[model samples]
Target: MATVVLPRSLVALFPGAEHRVEVGEVGSVSGAIDALEARWPGLRDRLVEAGPSIREYINVFVDGEPAALTTPVPPRATVHVLPAVAGG
Candidate 1:
């Protein structure tokens, strides 16, 4: 199982949202997302678009390295879901 960490900003969208989620036995990042979506219905929709691609404003990391949805998620790896930051 891999650990998926959610940014504080995203937590607001759900009731009783946890800062971290455990996705069991998932192979790809998308699978891990499916696991999360199984637990929280609307979560995946917020992270991905119609083509099942990750939204441009969002970023996902696997084990501290920047990764895309196709990135493999090994067992026990950490997946961080963060919003892209913008500054003036």
Candidate 2:
């Protein structure tokens, strides 16, 4: 299983959302999102867009490296979901 670290913003939207969730064998980031969506309805909407791509304001990292939906998720890898920040 891979460990997925949820963004605080996202966690706040879903009551009872865990900061870290363990997802079963998922081939790619998309699969992991699907697994999470199964647990928390509407979660995928916050992370991905219509094209099934990561949302413009969201960033996903696999093992601390930037990644996309197709990025491979090795077993026991750590996936981080973050929202982009901006300020003037």
Model 1 residue 31 lDDT? 90
Listed per model in order, the count of residue pairs whose N, CA or C atoms clash below 3 Å is: 0, 0
Model 2 scores a TM of 0.95
* Candidate number of the best lDDT: 2
Per-residue lDDT of 1-88 in model 2, one digit per residue for the tens? 8999998878999988999999988989999999999999999999999876999999899999999999999999999999998889
RMSD of each: 1.0, 0.8
The residue pairs found clashing in candidate 2 are: none
Mark the 10 consecutive residues where model 1 has the least summed lDDT. Answer: 16-25
Model 1's alpha-carbon lDDT is 0.90
Candidate 1 Cα outliers beyond 4 Å, as residue runs: none
Q: Residue-wise lDDT of candidate 1 within 1-88, one digit each (tens)?
A: 7899999888888888789988877998999889888888999999999887999999999999998889999999999999999989
